[model samples]
Target: MRPIAILSVLAGLSALTSPAASAQDRPPRPPAFASPEVTAEKKVSFRIHAPKAEKVQLSSSDLPDAGRGLDMTKSDEGVWEATVGPVVPGAYRYSFNVDGLAVIDPRNPATSEANNNTFSLVYVPGSETSDAKDVPHGAVAEVVYPSQTLQRPRRMHVYTPPGYEKGEGRFPVFYLLHGATDSDASWSTIGRAGFILDNLIAAGKARPMIVVMPAGHTGPFRFGGAGGVSFETQMAQFEQDFVKDLKPYIETNYRVIADREHRAIAGLSMGGAQTLNVAFGHLDEYGAVGVFSSGVFGITGGPNGGAPDTRWEDAHKSTLDDAELKKGLRLVWFGCGKDDFLLKTSQATVEMLKRHQIDVVSRDTVGGHTWLNWRDYLVEFAPLLFQGK
Candidate 1:
């Protein structure tokens, strides 16, 4: 063969033997780790590649029947794996504990709100109520406003229903509140309030309205400390801030019907207590009130504290007068989970309301004090607002 022909052959051999060419010839790499894989059967398989870790465990916000806080086994390749549920269709927050250190799944990008402590979020789409469908979605905006009562700046998450921007007509408003330790963003993020409202409104199950989720913490009020402010004083400040500052800001900014008949207030846990405290007194401001997974628990202090003074009930009794409440209030709903520790408080409050001859809608939903129950409460409560007005 000629020298040129030999050189061309050598070049071809080198091209074939190159690392890039050899890579193509080799077997395809295994599929990258997909943590929290929801299977067809509704089971979820969680995986994490932690080779050096001695032990890793999985903790999830799933229901008890769905196998929460299960131990994961390590594979030969150093991947920790566990499968849980046949879980019911809904969104869940989960995290991995690597040898006592709680961490989020590195492979899962979906996450809950940072205010709720930022956990890996997974949604098993099934029901139209909780799932995001091909319907017109609402817009959520994080708004900052000055709190004159608290004498500081604060943030809130506002949700305007579909067609809010183009429409000239003013809509009803739902002032929603979050639980303790959760910020204003909790409702739209972890509770999925935006999607829930969108689905309900698209299906005509609920009326389109603006939702205002405000930060429940008005000022720093520590529990059981020398310089700590009393719960009553803190609540009074919050009420002043909410009614004076927040309400005026929202009414001035948003195109909402600013009347008692068109306004509603609802909350979960700590916010629930605040709801009862604030709305029960001001029946002229809110036509509907919803308290979920909480009652007069924190207001009077939890079980550790002594029984709430009779003056507490007396004050609400004075404000929630039977004739006034009947004349102005459209709905006064209270709900708690069967497994929730606050069940007794809710039941007692319901009895008290009934004794005052004020009609109350009491719901005993399934599950504990989790976001599942809060979302369900919102679904049930939103339709009741601004209805028959």
Candidate 2:
């Protein structure tokens, strides 16, 4: 070999044998973290390999100390970890906050999507409501339909009960609504409505019905709007779309009884307010109504403005007499957690309905305004629907 080529080859060999190059050529080391591990006892142990993080904590939805950050301790390996409860059987959303920044669990793939935030999900099996049992499952579909009322396209989720494909018979329909910030998918994903209904129906505790979950927002209207448009306007548009567009679509496409006796409307939080407004206004349309963790803020206004055309209270009172209402209305169910912020409003609304000669079925559970309470409410409310029809 030439002298220059010999020197170049020696340099190349020296570089290849260097410690940094040898380290780079070696296979990467596996992660040392074991996170979000569910133990046999149902306790969830979470860990994050953030050696340089100043602090780390875990926040969860509806768990014992939900919304409050549970402090995580650091190990000698520089990993932070915390073991949460023998958690109840359910699907839960959670995230890790490291040095004031929120992030999803890198180790867990199960997640929930919301308008504002995405969270990691963990399911603990055992509870009757959340667990997947050895029973037939219902089908859930994402449906998009034109909205003449809103002058745009809208999306909804429809849940058909098991054995619906066989075309056994026309079923009752439940219009389930989500809260202010949630979308139509909230019920099926995080709320576990499908599982709850399946379990209930299989046990013969509740009647099988088609569940229609529609988007609560209508155009520019939203919860607590600050611009010239009021929140009521948005609600009115939603009610219009629900009554005119959504109802017609369901009746035309699905085998549902299109009358008051077999129709029901129910919601949570803001949706509960919408339920009171829509169901009460259309007594001839919906026989049953379930309101969870919310109530009419006042009697003077409703989804529509105070105009005679849009006032739910006025319409409800004017459309039917006491005897007619008593005969037509089947269920007026009200549910709220004992510690819910809306407890007073719910109780007051129940009293108001009773004063108006409406029989209200009231239920107070032990939790706050979380999916836990909403799931319980649905379990109780679904059985009461379409009965004696």
Instruction: Judge candidate 2 at residue 352 and give its lDDT.
Output: 66
Candidate 2, residue 153: the lDDT equals 89
- Provide the lDDT at 182 for model 2: 73
List, residue by residue over 143-230, the lDDT tens digit for candidate 1.
9999888778988999999999896789999999988656787788778899999999999989999999988865444555235556
Candidate 2 per-residue lDDT, tens place, 1-389, comes to 99999999999999999999999989655367666888889998888888789999999857666478989998877788988889777888889999999999988887876644688878888887657788998998999999998788899999999999998899999999998767788888888888888998889888889999998876433446754346678678888998899989999999998888999999999899998878767777888889999987654343445522224445566543467766778888999999997887788778767777778899888988898789888888999888766
Candidate 2: segments with Cα more than 4 A from true spot: 1-34, 219-233, 298-316, 319-322
The stretch of ten residues in a row with the least summed lDDT in candidate 2 is 302-311
**In candidate 1, residue 104 scores what lDDT?**
94
Segments of candidate 1 deviating more than 4 angstroms: 1-31, 63-68, 114-116, 218-236, 298-308
Model 2: lDDT to the true structure: 0.83
Worst 10 residues of 1 by lDDT: 219-228
Model 2 — TM-score against the truth? 0.84
